[model samples]
Target: MRKVLLILVLCTAMLSAQEKPGESRFLLRGYAHSGVEVRGDETTFVGGSFNPIFLWRQSDKLLFEAELEVEYENGETLIGLEYANMSYIINDYATLRLGKFLLPFGTFAAKLHPAWINRLSSKPLGFGHDGVGPARDLGVELRGGIPLGEAKMTYSVYMINGPALNDGTNPNVEPEEAGMLLYDLGEDNNNNKAIGGRVSFLPLSNSSMEIGFSGLYGKVGNVESKYEDVAALLYAVDFSYVSKVSFLSGVVDIKAQLNGVQVDDASYFNVEDSSNYSFSNKSSAYYVQMSYRPVNMSTDFLNSLEFVGRYSELSFPEGALWTSDQTQYAFGLNYWVDWRTVVKLSYQFADTGAHESEGEEGEASNDAIFLHWAFGF
Candidate 1:
């Protein structure tokens, strides 16, 4: 808490120092959301969050940015740091960044995660908090963009403290988290650092479409431990396309991404007994979404209405004790109050796939409806 206060004071001092021409620039912006959810014979006012982003531009070549998330849950207030990073432009084509930053493994983490920006009330399956893919990390990054004649290309490369795998051997670790990757920041359990990056291309001359590929590789075990040799490899492909169709009299937007994770074969301690076990240690997740809005229509209310649909899936390694194959279908209707504010109503259905002995038909869970209002400031 003291560190956060210090940082805020420094930002304020910097902003106050800009009394002359060619001075620095400071900006405060972020998003917040509040909502209610309804399920089988139950209705509850969902929790909410206030996320504020701070930015300080010291010069044309140097800048700092950070984000904070504050939420109230379980009768307690929780504060979290999303990221805090300083960036320096090295040249026209490259820049250097250091400190905690969101992983660019996919566009979602680094780009489209703000509550006001997401069309649906909830994120896709196996995504967002405690998702299957990597999120933010303390690291050094090199990023830039290039022009390919009429097309464009961009890239990012980074390295950070690698994630640690839970093997159910530690008393403090939960048995349900065994065989899963954990991103506990502050210190490294080993000397190895994770390496990752993302590269994307916009082949369309108008820049209406983009395709991206990203991956990360690292050793995920403690040094000198029996699981030291265990490593992980992950990859993802993502795409976005948006166009204005005259025939439909509306704008069509489509986005999709698929992520795959593979960990080296390893034996893990069975917390239930004095034994060990191993599995494929492979998992994957994906989501496809589309939305339409009659922006060019007649009245303000008519043009502000948007319809969205999404399908997502999560496939966890089945042999693990805490594993399941899950799928989600979501549909939403949004009212755009403005460019940065929206009221959304949505419904989602979750299906849990059966195990080998549970038969073919998976068990379906109760579907629910959500009403949320998101604002970006």
Candidate 2:
């Protein structure tokens, strides 16, 4: 941890020292949110986050960017390096980036994750930093945009240290539990690397609609006698649409997104007891949201207020080791205090399906309410 901090400090100093005369060399910006929530009759204060982002323009084609997030929760403080990367723009068709950064598998992680940008107070199920999808990775990436007539296309391809696998030795650990190997930021467990990319298309020149496809392939596990290598593959499709419509004698904005992922099964063997194991796992998730605002209201507060509704779900195949399928319904109101600040209140209804074992079943559910204030600069 000390080494990481030292590296960041040294990088910052180097960038500052390289600044040319009369030119601004660095930009600092980030977002934060604080809130209070009630769940199952228990209320608590949400301490929120203090994130600092730095950007250094080394030259016309070279740039450096990094972000550090400090969060407090339940009387404990946690700090994380969200991303740090250097990029070189070779041309309009290709840009290369190196170091740790957010995965380019979907639009949400890179585009809509900031507290001030996202419409909801909470993330969708199976899509958080440690959720089923890949949030970030240490790797090298090639990304660029292409102009095609009146439309456009963008692409990102990368190679990185892939997910880590379980050795399948502990009796309490099932083979299918390997699905939990989504985000491993430490050392690479295996010699192989993962390859992934996403491609997006905008068919209409004047429309805010985009369609995308993403995929990943890699092998998980070490090449040891006790452990068998597992081939991991994932594929996803997503789309987003945004538009303005007239409503209630005012203008309302409509925005929505849908996406899902599929993963292949893995096989392994235990050498200690000559046991063979296989994990058949497949999962998917999706969410849709809509918001309405009365732009022409007489009062400033009423004009700044917006109402929102959303529904999301995450599901897995039956009999899987992790068997709790979840669905959530949420409604909220957001008031824009200014261009960079917002106050939000939301209520969520969550239902988790029953897990069946030997004819017995149990399920869980919750209802929660939250009020939060967010700002960015």
Candidate 3:
């Protein structure tokens, strides 16, 4: 990965040299956030990660963009690349992106993950590595925007290295993680590639509302492994609406999404207790949120405040040994210092239901309070 980045940098130099003076330039931009959180009885500060984005425009047809993440985890500082891609414009309506990039599986992961734009300090439930979908992946994709009369439409489609399914057949694999799918498997484990895309439509001429549908189908098994034939079909439906309501004298925003994942059934052996198990491998998650800001209020302080609430849930297959159901509720109030800066106070609680086959382990009190400050630069 380092060698590839170096080569891209050299290519950028070559492109810049060929361009007329002042025709090429570079920009640095991204968002950072810091906060305090009280999760159950544990308290900590959330400043462990920093994200930076780099953009270089080498003429109109050629451009390069990359995002790097630096974080402290488990006693060490780690640097990781979220995406490093070069884009070539095919025309006014289409562009091709090559290298690692954020997957457009849903609107939130690809478009609204920035700290200042997320409206809340924490991400919705059913997201992240072991959740519903992938954050990013390596491959190439085609993206475009189209005008359909007064309404607008946008799309993205791509193919990437196959995701790996953890069957927990090996001694190192945990029984609870057996049916999970890992998108960042580092390298391809089979000859097949994963293909997926997202399409969103704005039906109104004002573009105040959007509806989206996304899907991905791929083989998630190693070629020679016992679960080689296992495959997965994943899909999501999402929607967003933002507008000012005259009656309330405020702006209301609503966002929601549902995710479904189905993997081909495969037998899993628990190496710990010498047991075997298998079940219909299916998982699903969903969340709904609504927020209101009194932009039309006479008092500036009242106008700058926003109220938010959300509910989310994650459901795993029932028979899996480590399977569990998770439900979460979050509420927040935010004060905008400016267009790009905000202070947030929020509270959230989570409920986890243990796998039925393993019986109950008692519902643990998983709740949190957050005080965050976010900015975009």
Best-fitting candidate, scored by lDDT: 1
Model 1 bad stretches (over 4 Å): 1-19, 356-360
TM-score-wise, the better of 1 and 3 is 1
Q: List the residue pairs that clash in candidate 1.
A: none
lDDT of 3 at 234: 90
Best by TM-score: 1
Span of ten consecutive residues with least summed lDDT in model 2: 354-363
Cα-based lDDT for every prediction:
0.87, 0.75, 0.85
Clash count list over all predictions: 0, 0, 0
Model 1 has an lDDT value of: 0.87
Worst 10 residues of 3 by lDDT: 356-365
TM-score of each: 0.92, 0.84, 0.90
Sorted by lDDT, highest first, which candidate order results? 1, 3, 2
Following a full C-alpha superposition, what root-mean-square deviation does model 2 have from the true structure?
8.6
Tens digit per residue, CA lDDT, model 3, 41-64: 789886646789999998789899
The local distance difference test score of model 2 is 0.75
